[model samples]
Target: MSSYFSSADLFRIAPLVVLSFGAFCLLLMEVFIKGAWDKARTAGLFTLVAFVSLYYYRGQFFEGSTAFQGLLFTDPYTFFFAALILIGTFITRLLSDERLREEGVGAQAEYFSLLLMCSVGAMIFVAARELIVLFLGLEIMSIALYCLCGSALWSTRSSESALKYFLLGSFSSAVMLFGMSLLYGLSGTLVIPDIASALSSMPAENMGILLVAIGLMLVGFGFKIGLVPFHFWAPDVYQGSPTPITAYMACVVKAAAVAAAIRVMTLLFVHGDLFSVWSDAIWFIAAITMTIGNLSALRQRSVKRMLAYSSIAHAGYMFVAFIAPETGGLSAILFYLVTYTAMTFGAFGITMIVANSFPEKTDADDISNFNGLGFTRPMLGVLMTIFMFSLAGLPPGLAGLLGKFYLFNAAVKANFISIAVIGVLNSAISCYYYLNVLVAMYFRKGEVSPSHPVGMPMAGALGVCAAASIFLGVFPSKLYEIAAYVVTTF
Candidate 1:
């Protein structure tokens, strides 16, 4: 009925287009360029393209525009996540280059290309207002990650991780798609808003089908976000995958999943009789997820595996925001997501650097590997301490502390005092293991000296992350304001 390619649509979709183009260019470089130096240059160029694209769209945060017949919505929420994913990808690429070169996989251009594609997919996933579009985005992101997880060609563990992630990810996607189909069948529409409107007018007898659809959908989202019961794959996958890829999975992937879940749940379920039906279930899941994640992390000797469990627990903390009544729930979740991204990325970056320092040894991810790092590599040691403290919700200008405080406060405001209390207890439980890392770095004695110096790229990435973690904690008002705007706009 109308022209589909308006200038407005082009403006709205520029970031996604640029990312896809960058990925394609990377692939071309891989095929055409025989020199290792050229491949590194190509990867750097791709990262620059991605950063520039995001910067060009910075105006969209204030504009709050929608385009492509409502399939894409560009607002503070979308801009927030889009920028986050792109920045994460850029940082990850920086980390990946050195690691690949060190591990003898530096010549592979496909790795960086796949990483960019994953970022594109994540951006699309967060912006989708239609179910089919959302599914496409999710699969695009997931498939790339599946390849990235197993990209360590020399390691059998990487292959195992890839296979497990692929199978489980496929099953979850199928379950979610089935749920979307059920909802479409019942509501006669694929658009989220349309489904909500249709459900409001439907008869009580259809409640059973709606319930099943919701359950299936939650199961799918739960698996993606690493919530308990659906969380069995996370530790294995995180441990088996490359450290930088693990960072991407823990931060960008989880953030996208949570953003999508919040959008869908808030649109359809948060305001009706449906809210009553599902609130308790979510509350119970949140409680158990926090407890299980914290307790499991306590027994892990491998720092990477410990942080995997820690990611699960942090997901549980984020879920606490879901149970808060409408006013503060979404904003709290968004704020916590931002803080979580910074601290988690910092932790993983530090882990990567530490692993790199121990080039002569296997199992470098073990906590004991960090022994006396405070004395040997004070900067990394201090940065890791900040990340660890933030993750534990410790005070003294740590963003994680402020994030958990806001989350728990929202829970209190919503009258979920018991759930908030359990979340607090879980935060306390998490401190022991998080602090254990710090103790190893500062107190325990190491058998050997540090093997390598921290590279400039890695150091810069860690600095940015650590600073964000602190700056956000000390002055969260601006971000909170943006989060409020995002929630109110939806």
Candidate 2:
């Protein structure tokens, strides 16, 4: 037992330990803060510090390391994802500080602490090489999200959204665990690599185990990805949470989940020789999920709700790429994630500004609110338009064009021409609603009303998102290169 534990292994996993340690320190800081001003400043500062520390340790990725008998694998892939998760959490914390202050949210400190812990969970999730480690990572991420959903206790809608998400999420998690158990039972091992090797040895005999495990794992990740039938909680959760928190959940949380899903599928399904049978099912799911989400989004007046459904649609597009059969598919998915994250964050950041001032009641993000936004808030409207256009896959913006190109390129390479066709068609259909918001902003004329003004801190966050969107779109090659490097690590 003593031999199983060593300081050297601990150093290899220092990134996780550092994040956990940061969470603890932030908790203590929250408790001892002198006042609201001090509390907010301290919270933001702590998040920044943690992020820098994590980035510094990312250099270790070049060497790659694992610990605890290969339970956790800290390769370049893990480092890449860990960096993304940390940055996403840092932005969320910065966005949340001012909002929490204005709302006088109780336990704001706990909120930051949980956010840090959630980051820790997400970082470990990609590093997990063993089934038990993966399960624990999932729970850590889910538990923090559950609390975040209901954190605004005074709002009935918030409470309702949290309850529904908790119930459904817990059920999905149970199914995932059962699947893991079945796989372990059949393979007589809990490590994913071992399970993959075991599956290959008896492809005919292990059919039952493969089917059950694949189905269950799909249900689990499908919930996180917001695919059809599993996406009921997304709209409500997006509508209820504080806007910044909603943005975090939509972009960062969803992205990490998809990344983990890709790794799992590639290892256990594709490498295990199950991809041939399961590819069709994934294709069908992608078609339906994209179609349904786009159709549902067309009817939504609330921008948040529209984006919620749009996220589901985006997930489907990712699935389309997921089924592709090229090494570049991995790189393509990573590229899509990069563009998606920037555009989604920028869109939501603009929405947060609007909501902070207007405080939507019936429809916080209704298209009706944007009638004269072009004149009233020129920069915000323009930024929001850019986001919408990017989402629609239009030109000049990096997200729509290159993102689709990469996915389609991979699809063509894999002989998934028809799947690529449907994906493009979905993009075209999605453009209508995305453009509708722009029409409301620029072409239509109506009264503009403002309740509260946005602060510099919030503006800074929006600016950060906007710059990233354009920068990523303009020079996607750089990001693609990094993604390619990371994907090769596995």
Candidate 3:
């Protein structure tokens, strides 16, 4: 093989390079910054670096490239996800500023550094083509997140959340690694395309090992994406972690996992009897994931935990696209991820703002906290309503409704009508809970007094999320076309 380090390779990995560099700088700064104010300035510096990186890679969105001899690949698909993860990180930094101070999470430098490192990992995860590189990226992202989940040293829940996430995340990684080892043993290669070719040439009786490998790999991915049987850690982790970190996991982490799954499953398995062997199993998982997520969400009084379950249901909806890999399924998943990121981040941003408003209430995430928000903070109430409606997949939630429409349409086109129908019914069931929050915000009467004012940073983040959600909903054709183009490349 030719040299992996070249001008082209550097260009392909530019975004990751920039993020890692920023993270390194932040880590070094931690030793010198003794004051909370200095740490806050460092956080701002991190945000600036992230924004610069985002702009630097703006043109890559239209230029498809590959690097490191296919260990890393870039196309519209990778570009979309890389940019999405970076943007999510920037917004999270913005959201984190106030929360860190309010919650007394004093290690601002470490927190910001971990956040950037996590973005680096997520970027790598989406762009990886070889299983080894993919695993490396996954661990980089997961480890940073494990630390960030418990970064709020003042809160015991933060520590607990971090510990739970670490234990579960490590187990999943082991399962995934074992699966990768089995796959390598069977195919004698780590590159995805080579593995597919090897499997095609292998004797039919050897298929049992391949099936088992696929199952193990799914267990690993199922945990990452918060699928039903493996999603036990999500709610506790989401509720216990600092709110901004929860937003990051919900949007960026979930997006990366879905992207990786689409690449690995559709690219390698869609070609042979492999797809049929796993399609029914994936379909069943999707159905149960959706049902259980929605039903469990209904019982949660904590808004953050409720969204946690909602995130699981959304994962199931995305999995519906997986069932129909050939017929617009990839495109549907891409579009839905974009919309999901926007709505989820927006909802969390609003939640953070609401939580910040009532600093004295330890149970700020309780549904009752939002009571009569419409009467006190009318603008927040409206934004929260938009996010809730979008999540529930109702009209005027144009982005979310259209996203679901495309997913179900793809499923129907691929002749997985039952999965699509089940997904639709789950959406219906989810509305009761999503709308329940809206009712508390607008209908119920209660005194609303916020301890801190809403800063421009928080406002800006919410504005971006709301605008994206609305824009995608209203003129989805362009993005839809882009998503379709990306799928063709894959």
**After TM-score superposition, what is the CA distance of residue 32 in candidate 3 from its true location, in Å?**
3.3
Give the winner by lDDT: 2 or 3.
Answer: 3
Query: Where is model 3 more than 4 Å wrong at Cα?
Result: 33-64
Best by TM-score: 1
Off by over 4 Å in 1: 38-41, 58-64, 103-107
Model 2, 21-122: lDDT tens digits are: 767876887667676544455556655765666566665556346778889877888777877787787778767866674332577767777777777787
Give TM per candidate: 0.97, 0.95, 0.96
Candidate 3 Cα deviation (angstroms), residue 25: 0.8
Model 1 clashing residue pairs (backbone): none
> How do all the candidates rank in terms of TM-score, highest first?
1, 3, 2
Off by over 4 Å in 2: 5-8, 101-104, 325-327, 360-362
The predicted structure with the larger lDDT, 1 or 3, is: 3
Model 3 lDDT, full chain set: 0.86
lDDT for each residue of candidate 1 in 368-412, tens digit (9 for 90 to 100): 889999988888888999999889989753689999989999989
lDDT of each candidate versus the true structure: 0.86, 0.79, 0.86
Clashes of each: 0, 1, 0
lDDT of 1: 0.86
Q: Which RMSD values do the candidates have, in order?
A: 1.6, 2.0, 1.9
